[model samples]
Target: MPTKQEILDLHFMDARYKLIDLAAFLDRVDRHSGEGDFRFDALKAALPLLLSEQQGRAKAVLDALSDPSIEPIEKATTQGASGAPRPAGVPL
Candidate 1:
């Protein structure tokens, strides 16, 4: 088993762009949202695609962020419509 710091550094510290790549995404979300509701909502939204194969890791990361001691603030931005909705600038 990897040490916690190793797991964290490998999964979160060097991640880029995508939330699934980062272990801390949930923690950040929890710290920024002021509620677990939003964090779990975001996780449920993302899980089908990003965490399907790594559900345990995803759950662990999310659970860690659920601590009441964490703060929450609204995220500065959100992704455009998911599924078939293409982001701006990409030809449909």
Candidate 2:
């Protein structure tokens, strides 16, 4: 099993790859499509929001890992009264 830091590192690297892939994909689409294409416009508009969300998630994970008071992620899950598993720090 990977340690917490290792897991967080993998998450960060994966996020970076995803952002790069999105940019490359968009570039390819832009090159193939003509101006005023709805798909290009839509993708261009959404990229920033997607980047922001990924950044936010990365920051949150980093913060959780860095803060000593925060519980370890491995211990941050439990079965509720309904016998359903749920994550800690997240409310259903």
Candidate 3:
């Protein structure tokens, strides 16, 4: 396994860019005029996980955005997943 310092040295810039990209994305969201979006809500809800000391952040984040429903809908309205849990009118 690589030392912590070695790992950071090799990946810090890539991580830095990702963080900046996330910030910029949020900024663009803020500049737009619109009601709340579930995707953004999911992203915001998962932000705290990045600061968490515990492991499983990735899984936790995925769970946050994933639909909790065990039952399948009669049919999907869209061809793609919304990337956020629960439909707008549906309760989790």
Candidate number of the best TM-score: 3
Poorly placed runs, candidate 2 (over 4 Å): 1-7, 51-92
What's the distance in Å from true for residue 76, model 2? 45
Those runs of model 1 whose alpha carbons end farther than 4 Å from true positions after fitting are: 1-21, 33-43, 51-92
lDDT of each: 0.51, 0.52, 0.86
TM-scores of the candidates in the order shown: 0.23, 0.39, 0.89
Better of 2 and 3 by lDDT: 3
Candidate 3, 48-82: lDDT as tens digits: 99899999988988888888988788877778788
Candidate 1 lDDT over residue span 1-92, tens digit each: 99988887887744554645455766676578455544355455555554456557755555444433344435625554322222235342
Q: Which scores higher on lDDT, 1 or 2?
A: 2
Error of 2 at 8 (Å): 3.9
Rate residue 74 of model 3 by lDDT: 85
lDDT of 2 by residue, 1-92 (tens): 99989988879888789879977886776677456443344445444454464547544443333323334355434453322223345343
Clash totals in order: 7, 0, 0
Residue 53 in candidate 3, Cα distance off native in Å: 0.3
Error of 3 at 29 (Å): 0.6
